[model samples]
Target: MTFAKIELTASDNAEFSNIGDETLDGLFGSNRTMPAQGITEFYGASGSGKTQIVLHLALFFLTHSNNPRVVYVSTESFFPIKRFRELLQQKLTRDYENGSEKSADKSKTVEEYGNRLLLTHEPSVESLMNCLTVRIPKLVSECDGIKCVIVDSIAAVFRCVRKSEIPYDERSRILFKMAAALKRLSVEKGMSVIVTNQVSDIFPNDVFHVNQRLVADKKPALGLSWSHCVTTRILVSKCDPMSIPVTLPGGKQSQLALRRLHVISSPFCPNSSTFFVVDSNGISSVHENPTL
Candidate 1:
């Protein structure tokens, strides 16, 4: 069989939806998620707030668009339903208090938001692939305004696949096919694809780099093959926790510790970092004045 070369043009008029946090959105250019029809990877250490960011993005996207929907697939079986509800309630309460809306109306809106978010748990690679290739497409077709698809901790799904059982070449081929399927879905469906990855320690060889010193020596998992699948990559890490004074619901003051977010790589934006705190109202920026 013979095939002709294919040429494609990048979308010039692509739109973006905010991830709910200003600092987080600003990491991507113009304070928004990467343009539609692209895959973004968020990788970080444990307790680095990667999942929190994903939940916040879903919340914001659902609220911003008319009849919006999202597909969130969790591989680690760690979806914090309590925390999600708390964040949702906080947002609804803030909007209701700030606007002239009634309490009953806010309750209805909260219910609708809950209904719009569809959650799926995939424990193995086969299940994940099936959901991505089969179930997700069906859900998108049946629902309107599905804006984003997120897979939390993609590394967890494939960590236990033995090389003896499945040869390295076969495993790689499967991963490549999966990546292609994800890319095709993003492009054809015109939706943002986001996936979270865990980090692996990278130690420099003593012989090759004896003089080099390193601080953060961790890198995203799944290696080079998976890297090509992602168009943007953000690395989140915890900085020294700072106790910042915060006002409570009844005008009481308390201290909160905020984590830092770093933008490791992107085609459209330069590398930058920001600080944020996860409170009852979701993630918010922390602005610290420079020390004299």
Candidate 2:
């Protein structure tokens, strides 16, 4: 079988280029989940920082608007505009600290970065799809750039359009419509789709359910159908940094680092998974954690 691989080229001057975090290089020390086309769902409980990671990626594409356009749709209304700006500032500061070439033109660079952010609000799947089908294409055409789409809180789009055993054709129509549109967008436009999802609690053991994501063995809220549609389904959860043990001279010490982890599935990456943390500073590959 033939497989498609991600081909990233290095710059002549040795500048690091990636989708926000450097984890894209070593898969964060494991298999990183990303889809060439179609939807890639990043599932986890609330506070797992799914939106933060996606936002960072979004900004990466946005700031480099000369390269490609990134369209982000938020369903849960949890977008952190202030936080996004703050991260941008931090990134700019880091660039300056590191003697980045662009530091000389900081004012123009900041304006360009701000101008590149093309985020729109869509409260529901229906509203979101409508915008996707109409506004998105035009935006991409005007910018001459359309490479990625981030649908933060993908499951939330179906909040009002709940999963019913009653076989509501109307509801299914909407669901399929959105999915089809997303798929069409990706395949037709050669765009990447990254979605955020919530999980149901059908876990066999409640051992790691302390995060409140696995509630009484309930299955993922969106059902198996949603998982089936996406090109990649990455399960994520928060781990008590303190639970992870590090042996010290005194004894085994625990580090209290809350991390966002991605456990890969078939056709996604590999046997193992990757870990990361989405905090105020933005998404950092767990492997590079200073505490680790």
Q: Which model scores highest in lDDT?
A: 1
TM-score against truth, every candidate = 0.82, 0.71
Per-residue lDDT over 56-138 for candidate 1, one digit per residue giving the tens place of the 0 to 100 score: 77776666555567778999875788888888888777667768432224536576777777788999888987888777766
The lDDT values for all models are 0.69, 0.57
Pairs in steric clash, model 1: none
Off by over 4 Å in 2: 1-19, 28-35, 64-67, 99-107, 138-143, 161-170, 203-220, 241-256, 266-268, 288-292
Model 1 segments more than 4 A misplaced = 1-10, 31-33, 99-107, 141-145, 205-215, 241-257, 289-292
Q: For residues 201-276, what per-residue lDDT tens digits would candidate 2 score against the true structure?
A: 6555554344333322223456645655777555666665434533322242444345544445445355344455
lDDT of 1 at 174: 69
| Deviation of model 2 at 93, angstroms | 2.6
Q: Residue 90 in model 2: shift from native, Å?
A: 1.5
